[model samples]
Target: MNIWTFDQEKDLNTTGAGLIAALLQSKPKAVLGLATGSSPVGIYNELIDMYRRGLVSFANASSFNLDEYVGLPVDHSESYRSFMNEKLFKHVDIKLENTHVPDGNAPDPDAECAHYEQLVNDHGPVDIQLLGIGHNGHIGFNEPGANLTGGTHVVDLKEETLKANARFFPSFDDVPKQAMTMGVASILKAKQILLVARGEDKAEIIRTALRGPITTECPASLLQCHPNVIVLLDRGAGRFM
Candidate 1:
């Protein structure tokens, strides 16, 4: 695990975007595992700029997003699918057919989870897996628990998790109580992992996730199990470290 702290937000985003650009340049067909959240929005913007500059092209690349809200339609503005399309994919040259987001509305989400895991196994060991930590140390909506799932699956959102995400919806009542997320075992299969975080609000959890005990209670701490993990943090987020 390699950790880095940056003073400027742009520097952090540019550095992350550069890493992804380098991977795409070396392997045009690189499989990218993506995440959505305020933490990654800047990085995605930097990638969009790289695409416009012709410094990077995702033409042959494939992408799998980290998670999605269970009840949100694909077209919903807050859906991970919509977030990706609006934030990065629509502005880049990537083939839409190659991008995959878990079908939140599938009749049987457990089946969808099984199918998603299979799809990832067939096309992945993602070359680069990007992640963002939750206030409760969740990753991909894999909330804290006594036990954690090992493949893509559905999760009943924790009360805190629901409250955290309610900001994106019109009201607390509008927030979905469930989500579909890549599991800890699934995320560890990535060839490389890029974990990003910002703001003082994330400080304590960041310290616990990256430097404390590896446990199911702090799913992000499980990143310690991966052989290759790069963490990018802003001053506030890395304050404890």
Candidate 2:
């Protein structure tokens, strides 16, 4: 695991975007595993700026989002698909068909999971996978547990997760009770993993996930088993380090 601490927010965003831009530059057809939520918004914005300035191009790249809320419509404001399009994809020149976000509204979630896994197998190993850690140390929607799933699957969102996401909805009850997320094994398949975190709220979990024991109890800790992982943190989030 390689850890980076930045004093300013722009530096953190630029660092993450730079790594991705470098990947796209070296391999125009590189596949990117992306994440949604507040942590990655800044990085996505930076990449959009890079695209506008001609500093980088995503014309030939492909992307897959890590997770999506189960039962949400693709057009829903909070859906991962919408989040990606609004934050990054629409700004770049990448083909819309080349980007994939799991269908959260699929009638048979099990089937959707299998189909998504097969898709990953077809276009993977992902060149780089981006991630954001939850306050409870979850990655994607893989909450802390005794045994973790190893393939794409539907999961009951933990209370902490639901509460954390409440801010995105008008009320706590509006937050989805379930989610479809890539498994730890699926994520580790990536050739490279980039984990981004910011703010003091994430400090303890960041430290635990990075320096603490590698166990299923902290899902993000599983990244320690991967050969290549990069951790980018703003100073507030790196406080415990």
Candidate 3:
């Protein structure tokens, strides 16, 4: 594990984007495991700037998103698909056909989960998997629990997750209660992992997940087992470190 703390937001974003850009430069066909939410927005913006400046290109890269809210339309404003399109995909030269996000509205969600997991297996060993730690230390919606799933699966959103996401919707009831997410096993399959976090609110959990014991209770803690994990933390999130 290589952990880095940044005193400036731009430094953190550029460093994160630079890592991805370096990977793409070495392997144009690299498979990317992407994440949504506030933590990665700055990195995405930096990547977009790099793309515009001819410093990087995602033309031949393929991507798989970490998770999607169940029951939301793919075109929904709050959907992960829309988030990616707006944040990074449409801004870069990556082909839309090569990008994948689990179908949250699939009629048979179980089948969708199986199919999505297979798709990832067929296309990956993702070169680098990007992640954002949730307040409860959840990763890709794999909430705190006694046991964690091993492949793509549907999950009941924890109350904390629901509350955290409620701010995005018009009302608390408007947030989706379920989601489809990659499992710990699936995420661990990535060749490398880049976990990013920001803000003072994330400091305690960041310390716990990174410095504490490896346990299923804090899903992100499992990243400690991976051989090539890089953590990028803004000063606020790295306070305890």
Please tell me which predicted candidate would have the highest lDDT against the true structure: 3
Ten residues in sequence with the least summed lDDT for candidate 3: 50-59
Alpha carbon deviation, residue 43, candidate 3 (Å): 0.5
lDDT of every model, 2 decimals: 0.96, 0.94, 0.96
TM-score of each: 0.99, 0.99, 0.99
lDDT per residue as tens, model 1, 164-239: 8889989999999999999999999999999999999999999999989999999999999999999999999999
What pairs collide in candidate 3?
none
Cα RMSD of all models vs. native, in order, equals 0.6, 0.7, 0.6
Cα lDDT, model 3, residue 149:
99
Q: Which segments of model 2 are wrong by more than 4 Å?
A: none
Model 1 ranges with Cα > 4 A deviation:
none
Q: Write one digit per residue (lDDT tens) for candidate 2, span 102-146.
A: 999999999999999999999999999999999999999999999
* True-vs-predicted CA distance for residue 65, candidate 3, Å: 0.4
